[model samples]
Target chain A: MSNKKIGCGCLGCSIPLLTFIILLVIILPLSIFGVMNGAFGSKGIPAPKVELPAEVIFHIGVFPVTNTIITSWITVALLILMALLVTRKPKLIPGRLQSAVEAIIEWMYNFCKDVAGEVKGRKFFPVVTTIFLFVLINALLNLVPGYGTWPITNYAGHEVILLRGANTDINTAAALAVIAFIFIEFWGFKFNGLGYLKKFFTVERAFKGWGKVFHGKLSGFGDVLFGAIDTIVGLLELLLEFVRLLSFTFRLFGNMTGGEILILILFFLLGFAGFGFVQVGYIFEMLVGVVQALIFAGLTLVFATMASEHHGEEEH
Target chain B: MNIFDKLAELGFSWPTLVAQIVNFIVLLVMLYFFAYKPVMKMLDQRAQKIKDSLDETQKIKDQAAVAEQDFKKRLEVASKEGQEVIARAMRSGEEARQRAQQEAKVEAQAVVEKARQEIQHERDEAIGELRQEFADLTIVAAEKVITKSLNKNDHQKLIEQVLAESTTLNKKA
Candidate 1:
């Protein structure tokens, strides 16, 4: 509540603050090299590298595969198994685990309803719930050891290798974003009929204003020429419709890739020399996963809300 | 991979669209039955049962309260009846005592009156005898005064006095 500290009361603000603290705690000591005892932690090791989740490891169709991929796959399987347990034979008196899960489901249900309204809430619950589960599963996998196994020949040539979060790869984040973006427009069209296409025409009305200018007070030849310029401006507005799709897809892709690259680059700089510095990257990556998930879901809720609004003139 | 991709990239695939559509609908139906419907039903049933239980509890408490009031009312009526009986008994006993006292007072008065009558009768007898003695003395005095002048007229006066005295004695006996 105090204004003296920079913690504004919004839930999102705590995220960056957590990131700051995590980075400070991990990297600050590592940058000083011998600031603390090097015997413990990743300092003595050549590279302070860690593993990723299982599902992403299995989804690895890329070169230079690592144990991190295996971790990502395990994360996905664990997520499904968790869902099965949570859903099967729910009791009136919930077990602690069941109670915790139900509390989360209820929170999402209410949140969706508030942001998207009742009809849209019903439509969006499934997608949002799936997104939440997927993100959580990936986050959990990082804790698992040797997640999904793959044999890679090292520089010394004895096979040994990898694990990682699936989202750390651009392919996974892009896949999720594409799925979300496609669904957003899909739901929009489903709810709004053919009129969903009319979003492109929102800016085209400027041409009508231009036409009126020449017809009414601006009837002179010069006014007609000016009206033509205004009509061209409306045409430019038509061009921007396609740009919305690019913005939607790229914004998500860029943020996720940036977070992943930021982690990799941090580790590359410090390797084993700056062991703790790499953990700062993982902490950042973790926060990024949470943010990306929230933003993806939040956008879905907002778009669904907007698309479902009454679009036409009301009849009295 | 290229040939397959090229075929798809070059032209539209009806089967893919149909399959995706089917998958989406199936997903919706599967999730609706398995997850959504059960959750909603559970919530509703829980709410209903809570309300019904509260209603039942209230009804039972009301019944208990009514029974308690009935028991209290009966106790008060029983106590009131007992007090009334005691008061009536006291009133009856008082009346009986007052009647007995009144009869005794009347009987005592009658006995006293009878004794008074006996005493008056004795007194009258004694007074009668004294009067008779006095009359005898008066007769002897008359005889001494008039011994020579004892004629028919003196004799007649003595005889009438003696007759009057004899009648008064018979009345006293």
Candidate 2:
């Protein structure tokens, strides 16, 4: 009831998290029930799907914006209003909301410090922190219900759901990953010239042609053999870059798709998962999605940091 | 081109795609306005506060260190002053002891001098009595021979001896 967050521990992180949890309680059941009511694919066990009584039957208007869209807008508006009300004017000595915000800031600062050194930390903050926030808010937004219903009607007079989990959409995840990869590569190229590619290729120091190479005995045979080895290593480096890109794209896609499918399957395919109020795995699904996004962001930083780092020492 | 036209005939319109893009863009913008700005501001402020707190903690530690050093300095000074006080007390004690010893020596000399004076007075008194007795004896002898009365003279001389002995005893007491 008080402005203060209920629990003493991690009250900062926990309060916003609790709000999301409450939202889940409302939207999760409603959407699942909606889906079970033949809005989505179905299994056998049939409850008389408690159809959300026509909340002014999805938009009859020509435009996409309607009741469902309005709700989405409200959700967005609520998020904005809360932020403004909590933050806006900074206090020298903070109240509860300020303290909660500060906790997140400290967490992020430490995260940046640990992953990227201070200089890279500052540079990466804009992108990395932005990604973190984007994924998080989107995840929360996906928890919102009445999306398909409130705006546009399906053929059976149901609300047409327009918006969904942005990351859950393959297009969104793939796009984000690709953009992040491109940015990382850009930073790499900016820092290290064309021959930075050589660092990955050419397993020069590791095999070392039996250490006589260190003795500077560049015999003709040694040169030829090492050159072949270098060429192969260079090919491997090129292969590895492709692999990095694929994995980056694949990882984000897999996690988000899995989370979305899991939730959908839970409601329509496996009703037992959402039976009663024991639909907790949905939250876990949300958590998994968040972790996936974080992993993606973290990988970007790692690649960026490594690419920008001094290359010569990496060989040794 | 005929197949594309047929698909278009099936009602896929560029306007819809544009509208969807517009919808997406609007959503993104709305999200940015709603969530991103506040979150970022919150984050920035929080970060600054944490840094400030850490700096404050460092300042407190510095002050504590200074205070500790000052306390140690004061203790050292107090210890030095304590030693000086002890040394002064010991020196004064020694001087008082010497003064008391000197006073005792003077008192002993005075006692000795008074005893010596008493002994000299007693010796003088005894010598004066002895000299007077000798003169009286000579005078008694001359009277006995001149008058030719031996018994009366003997009696007078005996009485005189008794009187001299009594006065000498009184002086000794």
Q: For residues B10-127, what per-residue lDDT tens digits would candidate 2 score against the true structure?
A: 2323333233334444544553554445555656766699999999999999999999999999999999999999999999999999999999999999999999999999988887
lDDT of 1 by residue, A174-204 (tens): 3445556567767868877777665544433
What TM-score does candidate 2 reach? 0.50
Any runs in candidate 1 off by more than 4 Å, and if so which?
A: A1-73, A143-161, A202-287, A314-316, B1-37, B47-173
Please give the clash total of every predicted structure, in order.
Answer: 28, 9
In order, candidate lDDTs are 0.58, 0.60
- DockQ, all candidates in order: 0.09, 0.05
Q: What is the TM-score of each candidate against the true structure?
A: 0.57, 0.50
Determine which window of 10 residues in candidate 1 chain B has minimal summed lDDT. Answer: B10-19
So what's the TM-score on candidate 1?
Answer: 0.57
